[model samples]
Target: MLYVLVKTKKGTLVGNYSSDKAGCILGRSSSSLVPMAGRKVADEHAHLEERTDGLYVIDGGHRAGTLVNNVRVKEYGPINKDDVIAISDYRLQFRFVRIGNNEEDSFSKRASILPVKSVEEPSPVNNEKMTRWREKIRRSLVSYMDLRRVNVADMDDDALRIFTAEAIDRIIQDHEDIDSEIDKDELARQVLAEAVGLGPLEPLLADDDISEVMVNARDEIFYEKAGRLNKSEVTFTDDAAVISAIERIVSPLGRRIDESSPMVDARLKDGSRVNAVIPPLALKGPNITIRKFMKERLTADHLIKFGSLNKSMVSFLELAVAQRKNILISGGTGSGKTTLLNVLSNFIPDNERIVTVEDAAELKLYQPNLVALEARPPNQEGKGAVHIRDLVKNCLRMRPDRIVVGECRGGEALDMLQAMNTGHEGSLTTVHANTPRDCISRLEVLVLMSGMDLPVQAIREQISSAIDLIVQQSRFSCGTRKVTSITEVNGLEGGIIQLSEIYRYSQRGYDKEGRVRGDFGATGNIPDFVEELRSRHIEVDMNLFGGAQESEAIQDGF
Candidate 1:
């Protein structure tokens, strides 16, 4: 006889099931017994059976679906005995205990063993035990004040004591249960060690000094601080715990990762970007990377203040957007591509209808006429999935004045370029490329992924005509992300696309603090749309193209 403990929303049931006599227990509830031989009943039914290593299954009935750990299960499958299961509106949790085990039975247990007269033999005793057990469990739980005292006493040192206390407070506010005892001291110590290990990298994330976090396993956790890679001492307990923590973080956000699905990309509440992968694909235990965002959305003024761009350069960009120029922000990964895109998007009119698409929705637009769309992963059965390309094609019918793609990574590049050419002017997007020249090549490669057989020249022609400006940004060694070049496409010449730099960042000498010093300056060639900015009463400084003296003067004021 196998003793089973079943907990459901209505109550609790302590019963036993025999595989030989019942074939398999079938019922909508613990009280109902339906045979499992008929086609309808066989297709949809719930039952429990022992499996190796403490696992069981609560199969779904035909009309009602089964859920494991609150996640809906599409078919019959193995589940751990401690797993929480849900069927339709009701939730059930199961635990398997061997009869005559040495451990003392919980308060919920009725007697040593109930006689198996029928399936309903223990019904009366089950009800009495559930009520008594709930009260006992409630009293055994610890209070928040007790947890705070315990965590404070466990602090090993001064620095850790302060950090642990603050971290514990944050966790308490974030978690739902205050009465549940979770060994707060241990939790606090672990989380504090995690934060301290991050070190200077923590300030970079909070200061908005960095834009991306890259971790190549536990030994190497790097962040793009000030547009350059900065190494930090962030370490995890072990590869297994790192994988477990990453899974815990992503799963709560409606995402999953395991051997079956080894790769996952997710976003944090603050719009930080996250990507994680686990072994056998990873080979390492599990790898996680996060790209932190600025607490405040960067505006044109902020760039000017940071000396990344001058007022004249800002004026030129503002006019370029106002004139409906299709702009592509190009950079390597973690080079502030999205940050620059967000800053430039501020120039978009407040009243024009806009549509933004991304794999994970991270763009924060202040425009009232904005609609954000995100891609969806397929269900477990590999159905009901939506891709970025599908969203791009559908955006065409949405009557958008501006179409903003958070990033063009796949076949959607072709559709986006087509959208730009077909009157979706002022469309803004970002792409990962080493330089402006590489951006065109990346677009061509992505267009080919669409399965379109257009010639290379035709693809280049489409790129040149569709994109008016390429703003290249990079993270320097000092961890600064600056707009390196703003080049205009001068159309195709000699079967090659011509690019002329309108603005460029000239490297000046480093500052007193040994940081990279640079100034944004124009190259003196008149843009095709110079008259458009002139119409807006925005003047360009001719000396901006002359020499370092003018650029130096502009930097001193900042």
Candidate 2:
């Protein structure tokens, strides 16, 4: 069965119908099934119908018009449950309810989790008693938090930790009958987690070794350290607690999370990236993911120490930047593209003016003449939304010596490429791709996203002329991130972009402890960019390309 429900000035109207009829009419005329009495509604305003495929609402050439989800309906389109339908002044949410013999099964099919059978035998539970104690402590902490008004922003890390410890001690000492066997130290940590830090996520964030934290649900948490994921014993009390932590993170930044807007992308005060999604889009409840940033800026030497890349690669990259060659770092997710971008960005002359545009503002460039711009989401009215493309267009007026985008994910790639081709010679950015050739293909796709309808050959010409180098970064199964390849783009040939591999990473299989063993070696192709470096009076070491040249390079401070 199908129905049309609308809220009018008189009252609510719910009418049921079947697909057997041509369609149902909505208007102010007497012939309409659900006649709305309003001047804005035409005599034949709109038509509602249901097909085997889906339910749809079509506009009937009315003056006032029909709208769905704030966008005017051009003709007719498929509608789903909970979709907002507007007719003149009133707004109605669409709902579909199935009737007949299979209704019970339909309801069960829509359920997120299956119900536990009453006759099923229970398995042995691990740490059930300890979980109960933790829940009690969490409840107590929530209660204490309600009566407290501490200025957390004014305290340093040590002061905050001390205050948290004292508060937990007072709460436990005042309620001795709560649980005598509960460990006081453990209780202190839990209280600190709820009161000061993100619950069940504080320890992971504190540990420098941990790189990522993922919250699947209130009671299920996971962390990654050294490229390996491990489930933690810590858990939240409920979904509300998980939401509270997310609110604590994004609210301070003037971002909101609720039914109206349930998804958000934000960054921590320390520049760690955060992405969150809540119901009803996320069936599991609220999900929070945090990508922790380093406390200290990582440099070329740090990469060498971690075996991510050798000295020769860094030296070549430094020269590439110095020679004003546009560079694009390509890699899969979590492959250290941004990290390598940061390392290479340091080579930019301090006196040159630099402009960086990003969604979350994660880049920490230290140039004195640097300008950073971040995109902004719209307000409740769906107005004032500033996108990355808008910022890229505006940066052109700022007289930037070099433009660096945190990452290109959309049509902004077109503007970034245009900016690179139009005298912004030393621009830098990262794109998501697996290899160097894939990077070029991804660029072509992103250029098409601009909706310019240009010829493929024109876009290829723009890409090949603007980008001089593509640095491929990859993360191995052993959690190692390395610069796998660096290819030089040498103009277009036979309607295809020509690429010369200057450096390549060869994997020597995994080591005994499951670490990836790889060595960075030159492909023996002297890059054309070397001549550009020499023209700029930069010294060149031909022997640096030799794999065994690390012996003397260490003495030369490579």
Top TM-score hit? 2
| Candidate No. with top lDDT | 2
The local distance difference test score of each candidate is 0.65, 0.75
TM-score of model 2 vs. true structure? 0.72
**Candidate 1 runs further than 4 Å off:** 1-235, 238-240, 509-514, 532-558
lDDT of 1: 0.65
Q: lDDT per residue, candidate 1, 452-502, as tens digits?
A: 899999999999899999998886666656778888988999899999888
- The alpha-carbon deviation from the true structure for residue 118 of candidate 1, after best TM-score superposition, in angstroms, is 62
lDDT of 2 by residue, 1-558 (tens): 444444432222221222224367777776775535556778888887776666678888887788888789855556765577787755554444445534433323222111110111112243344456556766776577667876667765434544555656666677677555555555555555665567667657766677889999877788888788887766776788788889989887777888888999898988899999999988998999998888778788888877777778888898789878899999999888888888899899998999999988788888899999998887777788889999999999999999999999999999999999998999999999999999999999998998899999999999999999999999877677888899999999999999998888787677677777756788788888787667888789976565452311111010
Clash number for model 1? 8
